[model samples]
Target: MSVFMISQLLIVIAICFDLMSFQFKQKRMIVTCLSVSVLLTSIHFALLAQWTAAALMLLAAVRYIVTIFSYSKRLMFLFLAANLVLTVVTFGGLTSLFSFAGGSLQTIASFSKSDQRLRQIMMVGISFWLVNHVLAGSPMAVMMESLFIGSNLVGYYRFYGMKLSS
Candidate 1:
């Protein structure tokens, strides 16, 4: 549950929201929102040497660019297909691209003899990471008032009881 690992997980959830937004034609507003969020995340992680997660966000930038490009249907399909293939490859860690290896439990175990203060710091890092994820990443999974989820529902709250707790 390292901060890096948590943000990485949130990236997946955010990307899912991006995918669904595209699928449901949520317009550039959604893309704009997600893209800006990713930008901020990339910047945040870059500051922390969480290079893997930052690189993922950079890749997200490329995807956003492609999404906004001027292109024919054929070209758009190509971009989409290429983006999907690259996304699967990167997100799957097919070649260790942006791999989230910080919180594999094995990681925490390796510090069994480390200083108590270090262990405490690690725990705090993980918790902060997890909270950052839930706050910044959960919005994409919801579609406001979609009927299947109920006409008056507020997406994440209804689906996962996930409020930002900010």
Candidate 2:
């Protein structure tokens, strides 16, 4: 395998950590694992030479780390503001619109207290990100997000039963 593909393997590890994060009942524990995954994912993006994705992942890591300490609405708004600023700064035409949408959804998700709501919003964000990754030619990111969606579906079914209610 090429060295790039080897670097992409980090995303797989990060995805595993992401799936494991939801298994925890405690919010802090879940966010902690998510923070670790995002950190690894940031490194993966950096390796792929995708500066925008790297920056977004780093910011997401910060968001998760802060979530472990507090779930304040103020913080969510801050994430919203940051995501907007970052999206503008990193704009690369229509192709990057998916990243903007995904980040926006993530910031919105941060405002919710319910795990079900969180998962739902995050799934949508992941879908946006999956499209962005495909367009950006990041195979690992596309693969990770696809698996993330599936994992989230399983978690949702297991936790919420048949109803998709939050």
Q: Give the candidate number with the greatest TM-score.
A: 2
Model 1: worst 10 consecutive residues (lDDT sum): 144-153
Give per-residue CA lDDT, model 1, range 1-166, as digits (tens). 6655654555454444433432222334334544654565565455445454456555555544444443244543454354345445545332222123222221231222322322233333334334433333433222221221231123334433453322
Model 2 residue pairs with clashes: none
Angstrom error of the Cα, residue 28, model 1: value is: 1.7
Off by over 4 Å in 2: 1-3
Tens-place lDDT digits, model 2, residues 83-162? 77876787776546787788678767755677788788889898888887888787877888888788778877878877
The TM-score obtained by model 2 is: 0.89
Computed on alpha carbons, the lDDT of every model, listed in order, comes to: 0.39, 0.77
| TM-score against native, each model | 0.34, 0.89
